[model samples]
Target: MAHKLRLTRKHQVALTETAHRNLKRFCDESGLSPDHALTFLFENASSVFHEETLPHRLRAFKAALAAQET
Candidate 1:
């Protein structure tokens, strides 16, 4: 028999409208519920981290910092 893990805690996060829209679109297209999409992403977190999928704002901040040195 396969064991199923129960997620007993709820985690809430705030996102910009654009981010939320994109996430919703992705979930809709992939046929995954929001919770399941999050679970799937969590399970493959290492790959996402390795790919450096930082949000656009954060990437822009990094670029700004680098430009200051030039």
Candidate 2:
């Protein structure tokens, strides 16, 4: 059985208008609600931290930048 988690804390973040618009556009393009997108991102980051070695993470960052440039 899975343990239940409670929502006990919320944090507010401020985004520039351009960033806010971009987030909305990306969510629309991906067919994701903002909350779902955020949850997915958080879960993926947790998995990466759990399984990645320092060198692997560094290499991953380099790969991400290289992909962005193309």
For each candidate in turn, the TM-score is 0.59, 0.43
Native-to-model Cα distance after best TM-score fit, residue 7 in candidate 2, in Å: 6.9
**Model 2, 57: alpha-carbon shift in Å?**
15
For model 2, state the Cα shift of residue 42 in Å.
Answer: 2.2
Worst 10 residues of 1 by lDDT: 48-57
Supply the global lDDT for candidate 2: 0.72
Worst 10 residues of 2 by lDDT: 3-12
- Report the C-alpha lDDT of model 2 over 1-63, residue by residue, as the tens digit: 996654445667688798689778879988987666565567687564546486787899899
Off by over 4 Å in 1: 49-70
Model 2, position 32, has a per-residue lDDT of 82
